[model samples]
Target: MKVGFVSLGCCKNLVDSEQIMGVLRENGHEIVGDPRQADAIVINTCGFIQPAKEESINTIFEMSQYASKLIVTGCLAQRYEETLRSEIPEIDAVIPIRDYGELAEKLQEVLKDAGNGSFSKSERALSGNPWSAYVKISDGCSNRCTYCAIPLIRGNQTSKLLSEVREEIEALAEHGVQEVTLIAQDTTKYGLDNYGRLMLADLIREVDRIEGIRWIRILYMYPDEITEEVLQAMKESSKVLPYFDIPMQHASNRLLKLMNRRGTKEDVLALVSRIREMFPEATLRTTAIVGFPTETEEEFQELLDFVKEVRWDRFGAFTYSREEDTPAWSMSPEVDEQTAQRRLDQLMQVQEQISLESNQKKIGQVVEVLVEEREALTGRYRGRSRADAPDEADGQVIFTSPREIEPGTFVNVRIDEARPYDVAGVLAE
Candidate 1:
């Protein structure tokens, strides 16, 4: 049957959708871009935050008009399955990630029961606008942060075997996928539960060996668990990008404890220093949560000062959102919505200045940028350098070349102009 898959939220969810797509293709199913053309529609959703949750629901409702069979899967459905079924009448069925194995069979059953139309599921080409693809190394979270509901939805931590993950990377590389971002709830915690210790370094080294894969980036690393071996692997691997995404939710030790985040302010700073010392050109990316429940003005300022002190190359900060079943959901002294928003704004304003300064330093230098695609608005092409990731992080290169550039090809671009979040350049001749 013709199946349309809508992948939502983070890269982890996209990996789930891609795996399901793989299964569908193996079963000779056709994947369609438009829901109207497809026999069924599958929505892989996010339940991480209020905005994401609402977006997922709206997407399902919109697709329901033409889709005869609507399958809602991924985090949102996994966490709130019954609520979704009761509220959304257009949804034919809700399948969580655990039950994704039934996808092809369910599609057949749904299409067969609707006797009005004939259905045939034939494998089609992989269609996406993505310049880079993500590979999930693990599922679920053992960290259980007070503001996160991931563990409740995804269950216990489960790391994919080293060999299996390498195989997946090879498959992606074989399909002409050049940049593969490694994703998980907490990447540093990968393989600890199953392998008796961490093995992220090993897994990444193996992936780096795969031919045709040029850029390897890792994301969602916890502050406390990044080992020396991992740092060494990143430094030595030619394919591994010199980028680190360490999530330190709060800077104050007291606030960190409340959020169930490991490491003190000193610990985090030390790690950052160590990373910078090892890879001088490394671009550090991090996320922080402001205005958590019981957070004081003094504590918030501590975080702001930390940001200034660290001067992270790229970073994002958000106001804490109360999530159900999480430890901090019922905590007293909840910061007012307005107050939370204000803190978030103030923090970002500071980070913006730091980011601009960092970008300014790149001017007049030639950096390797993976040419993603030609921009529709400017008629010039857009892509990212080693310092930038695909979306949340900044993209560096806006270059004009005499020759047409493919999406996965990497070329050196000279930085001519710099902005807070992006850079403009011309391809180096």
Candidate 2:
């Protein structure tokens, strides 16, 4: 049977989709990229926020039109399995995140000839860039932020064993993956649940020992959990990229408390200062939530000020989404949608200026970029430097290569122009 897969949401969900594909392939099922060509289509849904939920639901409907047997799995399925099954008669199977271990059997039940192979937890059918992959170090979130639905959807944090994580990366490295971005709901909290202590640094050291892997990046380092040891491990490791993706969420001390975040405004500032002090060339990326419940004009201004002060190399902001069951859902003085969107726009404008200024500083600098693609119309190569992650929020280096450069090859490019979110340059002679 042919199986089509549609992975939605974050890179964490992408890992799950990859695992599902791996399971299907092991069971002798052919994986098809197109829904029209498949006997059944598996849709990995995301329910992190209202907009993401709507997008997931809409995707399910769109895939249903192809008349293929539809299977829904992931956060949305985990959170609203009953609602989806009751409402959508088209769905054949709805597997939540908890049942991912039994994915083979679930598919067998749905498609009689789907085979009886057991789920391979470690196997992944890499979907995106062949040279880059996202390795989920852990799952779920223990922090239980007031505005976050991750805990309700995916439960608490569960880190993979250090050996297991190493094995996965070794396999990826053997398969020609040069860069692996370690990701989780909170990567800093890795190993606390099972190992009794934070083991991200140890994990980094272990991965650094692996051959064939060139760049190792870690994302979602919670501000409070970023220890000196972790930074030192990154500094000492040859493979680990000096990129920090610390999600601040908000800058106001009061809002941080309300959101159940562990750190205060001062703590975050100090962390940024400490990181810059240690590695002046390190790439600092962060995210902020613009409008939360009871967020005042002063609070938003504080966040804006923080962005200006820190000048993140890459930054992203989101408007608050009031989801039910979360603590912030019923909080009084809710920020109206209009006000929230306005604040989000205002925050982004400030970030745009900061990003432009930051990028401008890189002008004339020769940076090593991992070439990814070529623009169809312009015929110029596009790629990212160590400072940029493989995401929409990060900037890209667009350059004219004298010779055609293959994707995944690293090359030095001299940046000549800077934009708000990207840079243009020429391949270095």
Candidate 3:
């Protein structure tokens, strides 16, 4: 069978899609780059919030026209199976996320007469963008924030075996993947439920020893779980990039409790200060939720003030989603959509100025950049520095080059100009 896959949402979703592709190819099925030429189309989706859900739905609808059989999978299907089936009659099958292991067998049965899904997994190479990859050390969320529905959808946190993560990293390195981002609902919470200790530092130390992997990044770290030891490991390990993606929802103690988030505003600020003191050049990224239930104007000001003081290198703001079955859904003083959006806008505007200033500091400085691609019309190469992640985070380093630089190759770039979200540079070699 000739099959195509469209992965949507987070890096975690992409990992799932890669596994499915790996299995399908092992069964001897042909994987096509073009969706229109495939026998079936599989869409891995994300249903975290209202915006993501809408985008996933639209993507499924668009792919339906190109493939004969449409399979809906991932968080959205797991969360709203019946709703999706009823709303989108074009889909032939709906596979929940947890049951991904059965995909190869299901494809065989579905396309038996067509001889499309009969390949073995070992024959197919582990696939996806080779420059960067996402390694999910664990699945699900243990933190039951009042506003978040991840725990409800993904269940309690379950850490993968230490050996399994090491093996996966070895496999990714063998496939020419240079940078791997360690992801989980809460990365700092890894190994707590199963191993009875926070083992991210140990696990990362092992992955750092693997050859062909240059940069290691950790995401979704809860503030309370970020210990001094974790900071020390990041500083000491040559492979570990000094990138922290801590999601501090708000900067007000009252609002923090109302949102069911652990730690006070002071605790968050102190952690930020401590991280900066330890790794001055470290790039800190955070996600903030605005207009949560009962968030007052003064509390919003407090958050704005924190942003101004800390000057996070990267930041994103999202309006509180009144998700069903979540504690914050029924809370009083429910902020209207307009107010939430306004607060989000105000927060981003302030951060934009801070980002501009931060990027400007890189001007005329020499930094290591990983060349990802080149644009023909622009006559420049596009790449990312250590401070920048693949997407979501900031990306820069477009400069004129006499020679082409291959993806995944590291080169020194001298920053000549900087913008709010990108920087211009020339190859230092």
Backbone atom clashes (below 3 Å) for every candidate: 4, 0, 9
- List the candidate 3 regions with Cα displacement exceeding 4 Å: 113-128
Which portions of model 2 miss their true places by more than 4 Å?
120-122
TM-score order of candidates, top first:
2, 3, 1
Model 3 lDDT tens row, 1-429: 888888888877777777777767666767787998998988889888888899999999899899888888889998999998888899888888666556655655555633233222222234555768888888888888998878878899999988888887887788778888899889998999999999988887787788888998888899998998888888889899999898998999888887778898788788988998998888999889998988888999999999998898989888888788888878988878898889999999999999999989998899998888888788788888889877666657787677877777899999989888889989898
In terms of lDDT, the best-performing candidate is 2
Error of 3 at 140 (Å): 0.6
> Which candidate, 2 or 3, would have the higher lDDT against the true structure?
2
Model 2: residue 276 alpha-carbon error in angstroms: 0.8
- For model 2, how does the per-residue alpha-carbon lDDT over 378-403 read when each residue is reduced to its tens digit? 99999999988987879899999889
| lDDT of the candidates, in the order given | 0.82, 0.90, 0.83
Clashing pairs in 1: 1-120, 1-121, 29-122, 30-122
Best by TM-score: 2
TM-score of 3: 0.95
Query: Residue 51 of candidate 1: its Cα lDDT?
Result: 88
Can you give the TM-score per candidate against the true fold? Answer: 0.93, 0.98, 0.95
> Which should have the higher lDDT, number 1 or number 3?
3
Candidate 2 steric clashes? 0
